[model samples]
Target: MSPFAKLLLVYDGSAEAQAALERCAQLSLALSAQVDVISVVDAESANAHCAGLLSDLAFHRLEELARSTLDHAVRQLTGDGIVASGYVSFGRLNDVVLRHTQAFNPDLVVVGHRAQARRSRWWGSRSAHHELTERLGGTTIVTVTLPGT
Candidate 1:
């Protein structure tokens, strides 16, 4: 078995994420890893923003979108000859990713680097790389960027 037998990849369907996915697909092939691609929806944000009457509906819609995105990612990876599966979950990205990391025990976690335009994320804007590094403990996190991005 390859050293990287279990690989976890985060995908948000953005162009940046697509670039990460492509690199992940290549790595999975070369390393013969089992890839788990997760698409996350921030339930905290959903509950905070979609309040009152439409909260439940908004949350449901967000969850459905997450599932759809995961499915598309899985299909793409499968077509790329990578053994992969898709998962959808709701929570803060860091928490959700860490939760899965604890469970999946992946050899490595791969993520796309966010653009500068998204530096104003909720909670004062931070890099996913930083969050994962802080919360993931011993897990290895790899950040991928599109060429010329």
Candidate 2:
């Protein structure tokens, strides 16, 4: 395994993701790596119930929120002298993450893993974290579980 030169962090504005961000910041500082924070907006879920009720302005607002979330994460890391940048994309979470990973070719990617819910288990219990770990060809995947279980 080569030393990490670039790190990609998948942020979802969750507590778990924030924990992962801290870990990434530590690693980036230790290894002197560049960090790229990405947030994927699940537009499918956003449009599911609302459908046409969501105006173009509303969609743009959501995009702005995503960008702001990523920017905040980047600021947290960069404040400690870690090189960082942020990006936001609207699409399937796993697909967008994978595509960005391919484009950036980062040495490592970090994500947060949520506990499997009972409903999800009954419905075949799969998640973007699993697909990302399995399908991301060259990038190493690091799934951070929240502290205290």
User: Where does candidate 1 have its weakest 10-residue lDDT segment?
Assistant: 114-123
Error of 2 at 114 (Å): 1.2
Q: What are the TM-scores, per candidate, against the unseen true structure?
A: 0.88, 0.91
lDDT (10s digit) by residue, model 2, range 1-149: 33899999999889989989988988888888999999987767787858647777777888888988898898898899998989998798888988888898999999988888889989996977878878897678888889877
Candidate 2 residue spans exceeding 4 A from truth = none
Regions more than 4 Å wrong, model 1: 50-54, 117-124
- CA lDDT for candidate 1: 0.86
In terms of TM-score, how similar is model 2 to the real structure? 0.91
lDDT of each prediction vs. the true structure?
Answer: 0.86, 0.87
* RMSD per model, one decimal: 2.4, 1.8
